[model samples]
Target: MNQRVLAERARRAIPGGVNSGQRNVPGLSDLVIAHAEGARFRDADGKEYLDFHAAFGPPLLGHNDPDVNAAVAEAGNGADLCGVGVTEGEVELAETLAELVPSVERVLLTSTGSEATFHALRVARAATGRRLVVKFQGCYHGWHDSVSLNVISSAEKVGGRDPISTGILPEVLEATLVLPFNSSQAVRQAFADHGADIAAVIVEPVPHNVGCLLPEQEFLRTLREECTKAGSVLVFDEVITGFRHHLGGWQAISGVTPDLTTMGKAIANGYPVGALGGRADLMDLFSSRPGGPAFFAGTYNGHPAVVAAALATLRKLRAEPVHAHVFALGERIRSGLTEVFDSLGIPALVTGYGSVFVGYFMTGPARTYDDLLRNDANMFIGYRRRLLDHGIFELPLNLKRSHVSYAHTDADVDRLLEAAAVAARQAGGEVQDLAAASTMGGAVR
Candidate 1:
């Protein structure tokens, strides 16, 4: 397809004409990618890129790993095309996760992360019979209205959080209580104020949607303890972190098994697979028709291709110490990029866990909505465009934290830092080299 023709055609009839909102970025919409392989791909215009986005981190082994591709190819050939039946793939994948995450007693798969988070809340309310749901500011739990508040709140904003979208009815926002992430004090305050009425407190243990905002050391423990004391279910939205940071996701690393855990993204090696599983009592959400928590049915929620891919992915992950490699590579990438910014005399810091870290030319140890929001968005956007031009692709979603995937080699890390140095010179304000580079490019020198 002609890149310009495809994009123009999409805009004509496709209601944004793209699968996800992030694809509609000003520069990205102008370039449509045709095929991807390994760690690189070409746009419709055939400009090759070092794919840093990597499908937002699910392409951990890199795009089109031979094994993953083979699995897909074989499934497409003839492997449980029925889409529903007593297939060993689903059971094997579930077993792998159960063995990996102690909290998971039973598992149900879905097509995307949103569904997993959605049903987890349903399970919580059904199990606890409470209506109120507590979520932190800046954490995104899909598009569902109950958890939409505080997604885009900047640090300087008057109130800590403002509902990110408009179509969501105000009544839905009423059920959501927004608390500052990484603040055990605020969580406690909410519990004291609305604990009795709240059925569950859902959160991304590490909020990566708006740059990666890690919680304080005692925050997770406090969340668990308070939720327990108040008789409310604690849900960990592990869609992005699941199986990426470790075998069991945040629950394993933190040693705090939530009442409910949602898994997606990497769960099926980029295939459309998600799951909500935890304590058996809390899993009654999947009960038989008319008896379950509510409606949880969809035709392709648990497709066989995705299930097989997940089984293959988990088998490999379980056999290999992926996190160990990721940790080592992450340190190199973070250190390399940190040095780049520092050498340029720019104000930036890199922070995150495992293979995920971000270069923020703003602050260090970002831990809350306030911390991430207060960062330099202007510089961030400028750097993003520069990186894309220099062949690195990152989602424009709040410029939170970025990732260092398993596929990233030492060369990849080196190039990333090199790219950072190049982009730093393009910063619109006070960047010494940026002035010279801009002038040379016929921009405002």
Candidate 2:
């Protein structure tokens, strides 16, 4: 069946014609993907498009990677799910995580990023015997009630408890203290007021959820120092940045290690796997022997096939120049797009790090979520939708980032730049020279 018919059937069977709410885009909501391979996917109508969405950044090595697929197939031949005992693959994967991540002395496997975050928070609370948690605005931990509030809030609700979804209890909402990104003062103040009661301060070292809000070094340092002083768990939610940026994760790059780290996304190269790892003392809380207060159990926590895929993905990352290649492609796309918009005399900020990029239709220097509020939502959405029309797939939603996968080539980068020029002109109507616009206080880089 075509996309329209499939969409109708899905809407009847599924809640909103999609399993995830974010997949239900405005113009491209009916997208029915048939199959995907290296750097590209074909729709049900058999039209192929270069995929920069990368299924929201899980496909760092690219879609259906050969090594990962082979490992999965090999593991499937031997084991499916022996729920009672641990497998060799599970032990190896955990060891690999502890070896790679700077802060991870011990690790626990989970099936999804959300689960990793949930368990991390649970452990943090148990470790400190504290009830409150702190998270930054625009940093999404998961759909769980404790860390779900204050993400993607309106200007009016940016600094307040803007619940993303209803049904989260008021007390749960009150337990989370939301602060602005890049604001060390706010963090210090929060800690000063509620230091004794705060269990953890969870942050995405880089708030990529809002399309790459680079964390200020001082801000990250403050979090580490305060959490250390207060004896609270400092959790880095590296679900999006873990394996994608570096084998050691962003903590290695920043040199400010947290007590606990929650990782997923690129770890398994598109397979279903996530992990929470940290200092042995904190992680050992999950050891459910006798009177262990923390409870951690999952039937499919380390499914053989998933662990195989993760091991294969990590092996490729260790041996190959995967990071170098994707990082180069990412720089190429960011620079190329910046030049495209600059030449067109359109005010835009193409911001990202490593293999990620987001083209915000606004002035430059996007340091926080508030800075992103100036972004023109229509132009941002229009540009992505236009690129989709021209056989390039970026999720046509505001603040959603595009990825550069290992499967993408320099030629793919060129193709994206060429298409972006056209899409920019189409979406960014009647642009003025950036020089002139800057004089009027309307320019940034």
Q: After superposition, how far is residue 288 of candidate 1 from its true place, in Å?
A: 3.8
- Tens digits of per-residue lDDT for model 1, 271-349: 8899888887667566633477556776775577888788778777777766787788888877887888888787887
Best by lDDT: 2
List, residue by residue over 271-323, the lDDT tens digit for candidate 2: 99999999988877885444667999888899999999999999999999999
Q: Ten consecutive residues with minimal summed lDDT in candidate 1?
A: 427-436
User: lDDT of each prediction vs. the true structure?
Assistant: 0.78, 0.91
Q: What clash count goes with each model? A: 5, 1
lDDT score of residue 3 within candidate 2: 84
How well does candidate 2 score on lDDT at residue 119?
A: 93
lDDT for 364 (candidate 2)? 76
The reply for model 1, stretches above 4 Å from the true place, is 79-85, 155-161, 428-445
